[model samples]
Target: MAKVKLTAVCKVCGSEIELPEDVMDGEITSCPTCGTRYIVRLKGEKVELEEFKGDVEDYGE
Candidate 1:
């Protein structure tokens, strides 16, 4: 078995975001440049990215 990498353009910084080929739908990852969060989805054989909508908890609060 071999690993494949998937890529998407960040909606915020326009940087390319590379992800694992086995990445599942709703998996969360961050952009390296801007550190913006995104959720990945399976769009047929390809993947799509969307801004993460889940609430962020501040443990320091």
Candidate 2:
């Protein structure tokens, strides 16, 4: 199958970003405008971008 480029608006900067069709679910992508990272989600023919939340860990402090 041929790869198709897709577009999604950034949840942070609201910038329309082009996403690669080969991008898998849960993949992280960053916004070029605000430099915010987001997780890509695929819902049928629609695409959703969610802000990335990092997992917390203790460094034995």
Best by lDDT: 1
Error of 2 at 24 (Å): 0.5
How well is each residue in 1-61 modelled by candidate 1, as lDDT tens digits?
A: 7666789989999999999877888778889999888878888878788897655563113
Off by over 4 Å in 1: 1-3, 56-61
Clashing pairs in 2: none
The alpha-carbon deviation from the true structure for residue 11 of candidate 1, after best TM-score superposition, in angstroms, is 0.4
Task: Put down candidate 2 lDDT per residue, 1-61, tens digits, no spaces.
Answer: 8667799998767898888868888788888898888788899988899887774232112
TM-score (C-alpha, index-matched) for candidate 2: 0.75
Name the weakest run of 10 consecutive residues (lDDT summed) in model 2: 52-61
Q: RMSD of model 1, in Å?
A: 4.2
Q: What's the distance in Å from true for residue 39, model 2?
A: 0.6
